[model samples]
Target: MRIAIIPARGGSKRIPRKNIKDFCGKPIIAYPIEAALNSGVVDKVIVSTDDEEIASIARQYGAETPFVRSSRLADDYTGTVAVIRDAILQLQQIGWTLTECACIYATTPLLNSERIAEAYQLLFDSHADFIFTCARFSFPIQRALLKTDQGGVIPFDPPSVPKRSQDLPPTFHDAGQLYWAAVETWMDPAKHIYSADSRMLLLPERLVQDIDTQEDWEHAELLYKVMQSLGQ
Candidate 1:
């Protein structure tokens, strides 16, 4: 069975209670829970959180909290992979048989069921260890600029300064919204998520937002409003 696991730990520093924070009239975590439940590709939806409040909110949105996440895995130093792996193990311990899984972030309010379903299908068709969302950079990274200590602008790649924008190859970054992986792939510690064995599902830049601060939260709200206005 394929399941969607959402890890939402408490003690958020940049944005307190960010997982359950109101976004467009609903909790931010509700989006992923709903998307996973509606995706049809997933057989189950689970939310692994250390806080009871988050678990309650997740249950309210039709997701199961089979176990409360431990403090060790909930720390800031712990990476997303660790949380996902832990969730899988806990679920298995509880007699749940999972074949494949998707790690959907708790704060991705812009995520939709269509995208989740598409990624789930790609995981099967491509037979990749991991399939995650990604978006192209707005500008070429070859001509990236950097500010020196003396407040002077300098090209990151000085040799590529003269190259035309069209000549540079396109680059993409992880959208941080969702990731699908086989059960064993997620269990293996040596399996790098960004390696060649993994495939990326491209998403439009308009739907990607990495919110880490107050300003970022505000910008995301504005973007969400605009997207909603256009019926996206």
Candidate 2:
């Protein structure tokens, strides 16, 4: 079975209740939930959250809240791997043995149903055990530098010559939007990205935004409104 797990915790230190914060009218978490449900690829959309309010909102949006996330997994320092593992375990206890699963973040309002479906399709077509969305760096990262304590600039890669932006190979950074992985890979703690056989789905910068702070939240809201107007 193909499932989509959205990990939303109540204790958000950066933006305080960011999961349920209003974004373009609905709660922030609702976007991912709705996208997963609308995505024809996902057989089940499950939300792993500790907040009662978030749980209620998730169900309202037609996502399943099979169980409240444990306090241990809800801690600020807890990693996403733990949250996902817990959710899968809960589902297993209830007789749901997933074959494939997607980890959709609550903060990524830029994600759409089409992208979700496309990512799954790519995974299936490539016979990849895992796939994640990423955004390319507009500028050449080879030219990046660091400042020293002596007030001197240092090249991050001193051995490499700086190439023109157009000449440099395209590079991508994890968009932190979603991850699609097989259940066997997810069950293995040492294999987070579904082993070494993982693929990346490239997304445009405009469609990839991580909302962690108030400024980021505002920026995402603005981008979302603009995209809606453009009929994206």
Candidate 3:
């Protein structure tokens, strides 16, 4: 069995009610729910949230709200692993067997079924502990700079100041979309998603955005609109 668990707690301090907020005419969380259901990989999609409104909206979007997350797990300090593990355990107790799991974030409005399927394929074929999406940095990070208290700039990596951008190594960042892992690996808190044993599915930087503030939300909406126009 395979499942997709989306952690959408109600206490969104940055963009208030961000998970269910409108994005391109629909609730932001609806994107991931629809993507997971359309992926053809997950047997079930579950929305693990602590808020009644979020749970109600999740069901309306076609995901199951089998459980309302505990206040302890819904707090800001609770980590993703803990939330996923708790959901898996709850499912097991209720007699739902799971072989694989995907943690799909509610903020990923640009998520598509193709990427989710690709990650699942890679996880199955390579037999890795975990897989997730990432985006390469548009600029080489080696020749970075830092602003001083006096507004003066200094080379973050002084040694790479003279090196050409093409000669520098490429770096990437978490796209903040989804993560695929075996149920066993997810159950083990010691198994981390960022370990060397895990793999990453690279996405174009334009298609990746993290909605943590009003500016970010506006930027993501703009990107989403442009992509829709381009028939992406």
Candidate 4:
């Protein structure tokens, strides 16, 4: 079985109840649930959450809540890999057979079926252990600046300060939207997802947003509204 696991614990400090919070219209988690269901790639869409409210909302959006997340794995220090691993293991314990899985963030309001399908195709065709979304930095990260304790600015990478933006090597960062991996990769803790064996599905910067703060949430709302208006 191909599954899509969404990790959405309730203890959010930056944005309270962010996983299920309303984004444009419906709960933010609804976007990923709909995308995964519409993609035709995943046979099961499951949500791993400790919050009853979140689980309820997930079920309303057509995702299965096989089990409530254990408090041990829902702590703030728990990593994404751990949550996904726990879900995969629990499914196996229940006698469900899983081949590949996709970890889709519950807060990605702009996530679509197209991107999810693209990542799954790449993972299969490239025979990669993992595949995920990535986006290029608008500016060269090598020329980034940092503030000193005294309020003075300093170049983070001194060597790159003299080089033009185009002269520096292009770099991409995780879009933080989705990750597709084989069941074996999820079982193997030592297999990091960013290694050369994995592949990336690059998305335009306009489609990427890390919604952490209120300002970020507002910005994403605007972007989502525009996309909706464009009928995209």
Models 1 onward score TM values of: 0.96, 0.95, 0.96, 0.97
**lDDT tens digits by residue: candidate 1, 118-200:** 99899999998899999999998988999999999999999888989888889999999999999999999889789999999
Q: In candidate 3, how many Å is residue 167 off?
A: 1.5
| Residues forming the 10-long window of minimal summed lDDT in candidate 4 | 17-26
Model 2: pairs clashing at backbone N, Cα or C within 3 Å: none
Candidate 3, residue 53: lDDT: 97
Q: What is the lDDT of candidate 4?
A: 0.93
- Whole-model lDDT values for every prediction: 0.92, 0.87, 0.93, 0.93
Clashes of each: 0, 0, 0, 0
Tell me the tens digit of each residue's lDDT in model 2 across 1-232.
8999999888888888889888889998889998998999999899998889999998998899989898888886888877888899999999997899999999888999999999999988998868999888986778789999999999987755555567767777889999998887788866757346889999988997787678888888899999999999
Error of 4 at 131 (Å): 0.7
- In Å, residue 158's CA in model 4 sits off its true spot by 1.8
Q: Model 4: runs farther than 4 Å from truth? A: none
The segments of candidate 2 whose C-alpha lies over 4 angstroms from its true place after superposition are 194-196
Which RMSD does model 2 reach against the true structure? 1.5
